[model samples]
Target: MAPIQFQVGEKYFTANTKTLTEGSAWFKSLFSGSDKLVLKEDGTIFIDRDGDLFAIVLRYLRSQKVPVFYNKIYGHNHLLYDQLLTEARFYQISYLVYYLENRFYAGYVASVKVEILGLDHGVDVPLPDRDDDTDVQYYPQWCRKEVYVCPRRVAVHRGNPGGCGRECRAAQGDRPLEYEDEWVLKTTEIRTQTILKHNMDSVKP
Candidate 1:
């Protein structure tokens, strides 16, 4: 049977489904001469220097396609991922939110101190438990869209936030720090209480 053909438009340029043939021309137009996407073995795609993969992801998101990719290469970290996901939710990208929720539920990434050791460690935190208490001391705070590490510790080993960006080394010289114990994920109960308090405070007599 012949396939259905739909008129190409700017919207098609951002389509992310596997069945992306009808709008090939329009999709090609969105890309600059130097812009290109490379598929990785992990099922993620990388864009050229001039092309922002986030835009592609957003396009797919608009088309209801799930976009899953971590952009914390050099110094970016899970905090950035969380922040991005938050923005994704704010913009009403259910697909991206679903993807982020899965990552959070499946524990594809680690919290902060507890590295992605395995599925067991990932399950330890649990999705609902994330909002309990954020252990900022060790895990670094994910507030205000930036990962701020303490300037008193050092990244003696890999993934350690020592001297890569912040000055959290000299602040804690040679002190065997216990960042792991500070895993403070927020709890649902606390969140509910805070919300209720805010509502009451905003109420007029």
Candidate 2:
């Protein structure tokens, strides 16, 4: 896959940087079952004392096994904040864009309280492929709430403009915006320098 090259203006950090192995290992154990990696008062990171910001980006660019799952009750802001580096590392995106997309998709990102470091951090991206619903079954239970159902026959809204007009009329004629090209992946490179600066500062202090 040549590691999916991102657009030039798109943000990306090198992944071959160094890490404080002992610190990272200790950090991982300290926050078991959670992905919140942070720095201690003395500036030692939980994951790596000398972790490379670029390398973390590469980890995400290479794998999808990591997902920042948080307690829905306690809220997921801290979880998301902590994993900003991780997400930027693996997904080849800026932390800002990553958080913004997740926020819009989840529909409640505004309430979460954490600072997304850059000025242009969370701009909205327009919904893409607004007219497709062929993958409705792939959606979560919350997404099925307003779906239109047809009882007389077995017709599902395929979201194609002319794909199922007659079939829907014969079975279930009603329609709702059932689905679109859900943006599970996107690029975010603008905040790379800022993050890199954070890494440098951590090392100095």
* lDDT values for all models: 0.37, 0.34
- Of candidate 1, the 10-residue stretch with the lowest lDDT total is 193-202
Deviation (Å) of 11 in candidate 1:
16
Tens-place lDDT per residue, model 2, 1-205, is: 1222211122423221222122244323443544554544754333332234334434433442233323434434554545554544333353333443454323332232222222222355444332211111111121112223333333543324345566555554464434434323223322111111111111110
lDDT of 2: 0.34
Task: Single out the weakest 10-residue window by summed lDDT for candidate 2.
Answer: 192-201
| Local accuracy of candidate 1 as per-residue lDDT tens digits, 1-205 | 3332222221223333332322233234333342444444764444333233345444543454333343323322555457656655544444456656555423332333322212212234444434422221223222122233444434453235543443445454686443443333332211111111111111111
Quote the lDDT for 118 in model 2: 20
Tell me the lDDT of candidate 1.
0.37
TM-score, each model?
0.21, 0.20
Q: Cα lDDT for residue 126, model 2? A: 40
